[model samples]
Target: MDENEKDRILKVEIDVSGKLHLTPEKKKFTLIYRTATEVHWNTEINTLYSPKPRDWTYLEWFKHIIKVTKEECYCELNITEQTEWVNIPNELKKEITKAQQWL
Candidate 1:
């Protein structure tokens, strides 16, 4: 599996009836959020326009469960948090630029 596709942000989906839906076989998990935005505002609210609403989406990806073992103990995890970051090394950046014909 592609390492990039192995990771994705997770969120819980709860119905109006106050029940959670989860399935490990389908890589579906749940996360409870305390608060969220109900609307959005533009850079300048000079015009008479209602604020843009907020839309939350869950990313679909296969989850990989790995077990970490040390001489002292073992740790098990079923859920993983996808971090938002990509730091390319200086040499890699140069290669990417050349490949894209920007250099």
Candidate 2:
């Protein structure tokens, strides 16, 4: 992976209001965004999923329920920096390197 791409500022708009409105059994945390390259996606999943359209109500199956009901979520990336070189973890570096090798 290019060092320049590490800190690429991607926009992700997550709408959790629907899930929060559902009953415990009927509702769960689901990914509101679907475009892998558009929004930062988990490369771990193999299938290419459709981008969650604006009018679409239910979320894609790829999305999983949030394990915790807690209000605080730290998983959201800290994107205050304008520089194009975010520090990534060693595991992600390995994954990025591996992906780059195929190119």
Give the lowest summed-lDDT range of ten residues in model 1.
61-70
Q: How many backbone overlaps does candidate 2 show? A: 0
Please provide, for model 2 over 1-103, each residue's C-alpha lDDT reduced to its tens digit, 9 standing for 90 to 100.
Answer: 1221112223212233221111122122244233122222233421122334444422321122111112122122212223122233455434433433332
Question: How many clashes in each candidate?
Answer: 0, 0
lDDT of 1 by residue, 1-103 (tens): 2221222223222234422222222222121111121111112321111122133221111111121111111222123333211232455334333432311
Name the regions of candidate 1 deviating beyond 4 angstroms: 1-11, 25-77, 83-103
Provide the lDDT at 73 for model 1: 16
Say which candidate scores most in TM-score.
2
